[model samples]
Each structure stands twice: as C-alpha cells, then as structure tokens.
Target: MFFLQMSGFPGSGKSTLAREIAKFTKAVIIDHDIVKTGLLEGLELEGQDKNIDPKRAGGVAYHIEWSLVDFYLSQGHSVILDSPCLYDVIVENGTTLAEKHSAKYKYVECVLNDIYELNNRLKNRERMITQIGPVDIPEERWQEVINRAKKPTHLECLKVDTSQHVDDYIGDVLLYIDK
Candidate 1:
C-alpha cells in the first residue's frame, strides 16, 4: 500500500492534483473539506448549536481522517489525504500511520508562485461554495496561513508549482509513485 499526503494552501490546487493522481493510482481520496463538512452535518444532526465551532469540527474531522487512512491502508488500499497539513503534528501522525501499515509514504506540496493569482483564485466564491462550502477566508488571512505552514524538512517531498495546468506534472508524479 502507498500513502500520499497533499499539503497546500487553500486554492493551491491540492484537490485537483489529488484527483489527477487518484485517476492513475486508483487511490481513495480522504479530502479534509468533505470530512469536515460531514462532521459539521453530524453535529447538526445531533442537535448541537446551529453555529458549530469550526476549530472543534476540524479537530474531529482530522481524527476521523487519520482513522480512515489507517483503515484503508490496513485493507491494502492506497490513500490520498487531501488537506493543507500546515502543522508538523499532522505530518508526523500521517508518517506514523504509514509506518504502522508498512506502506510507502509520499508527500506532495502544491504552491502557487503568484500571490495575486492565488488571491484571485480564493476570491471565487462560487468555486469555494461548490468545493468547500462557504469556508473561504478573506485574502488578508491567506498570508497568515502561509506563514504558519511548516514545510516538511525530514522527508523528501515533491514540490509542485500549481500556478499552471497540473497535467504537466502528472508524469513526474507518476514517476514518483513508481519510486
């Protein structure tokens, strides 16, 4: 089994690249936004307050995401974890999960070199509503997220510039997977 973890800021095309990789690898995608949305729905179903705290929901979603990764890996299936993964703890936990399953772990970091383009992408409310559902942060907050992201130093990661079409890098990603 192989475990692929994606790290990138919002609107950096992490999910897009994950899907492209999944098409070639046939890996199951554990998208953080989808999981967090589900957790929020579960909270609503449980009669919790209508305005559920994003942080609390995100914590539960991450827990569930890791559990799902473990479960799928245990079943000998490759998994693509699609998330920002800005924190070291998240990367460490993913590494641990991969080791526990005796699977090859790979990390992919997507980046947009042009800040203006990234901000423009983030400002697309329709796209955000379709993908992440109204969780778009203001343009000013994007820098904070980028500043807080701890780049993975301990592991060899593939750095992808997602400012252009991601298909150009699919072959490279496939080669990495073969490694």
Candidate 2:
C-alpha cells in the first residue's frame, strides 16, 4: 500500500489532482475540507446557537483524518490525503504516519505561480456543502498565504505547477512511488 499526501494553497488544484490520482490508483481519499464540513454540519444539527469555531473544527477534523488514515493503512489500503498542508508539522506528521505503517509515502505539492490565474479560479468556485465552502482571498491575503506556505524539505516529493495540466505529472508520481 502507498500513502499520498497533497499540499498546496486553496486555488492550486489539490483536490482536483487528488481525485484524478485516486481514480487512477484506486486509493481512498481523506479530504480535510470534507471532514471539516461534516463537523460543521454536525454542530448545526445539534442546534448549537453559536457560530462554529474554525480552529476547533479544524482540530477535530484533523484528528478524524489521521485516524482514518491509520485505519486504512492498517488494512493495507492506499490513501490520498487532501489538504492545504501549509505548515511544516502537517508534512512531518504525514511522513511519520506512512513510516509507521510501512507504506510508500509520496508527497505532491501543487503550485500556481500565476496569481492572476489563481485568483480567477478562486472567484469562480461554487459553494458546496460537502466542502469547507468557498473563501475569497484578496490579493494581499493570497500573497500572505503564499508567503506562509512551507514547502517540504529533505523529502523525495513531486512538485507540480497546477497552472499546466496536472495529469501530465501523474505518471511521474507513479514512477516515484514505484521507486
């Protein structure tokens, strides 16, 4: 079994590429947005009057995500973990989890250098209940997100610029995992 983790900013096409790769590899996907949205929906269903705290929801979602990863890995299944993975800790934790399960770990980082294209994609996204919902990141905030994103270091990872065709990199990723 292999474990694939996707890291990127919001409009960088992480989820799209994750779905394509999952289809090709027959892997289960554990998406952060989906988990967080489910948590939010549970709160709403519980009749909680207060607005959900994103930080708390995110914490619980991550816990669930990791638990699912552990379950799938133990069952000898391949998994595609989809998330922004903006921090170093997230990347490190994923790597550690794969190691613990003795699964091939592959990290794919999607990036779009063209801010204009990224902004357009972000603006055109439709709201979905299954997703964390569309967030409008202004130019300045987008720049900040880019500045804060930490690329994985000292790891054999694939970096693809999503501005181009992401499918073009699937073969390369497969080859990397096979290695």
TM-score of 2: 0.86
* Shift of residue 102 alpha carbon in model 2, Å: 0.3
Global Cα RMSD, each model: 3.1, 2.5
Which stretch of 10 consecutive residues in model 2 shows the poorest summed lDDT? 127-136
Question: What would the TM-scores of all predictions be?
Answer: 0.86, 0.86
Model 1 ranges off by over 4 Å:
125-147
lDDT of 2 by residue, 64-166 (tens): 9999999999999999989888667777778888999999888888888777888678768874454433456676666576556565577788878788886
Candidate 1 structure quality by residue, lDDT tens digits, 104-167:
8898888875667776777764452124432345667665655565555777888888887987
Reference-based lDDT, residue 59, model 2 = 80
Per-model lDDT: 0.81, 0.80
RMSD of 2: 2.5
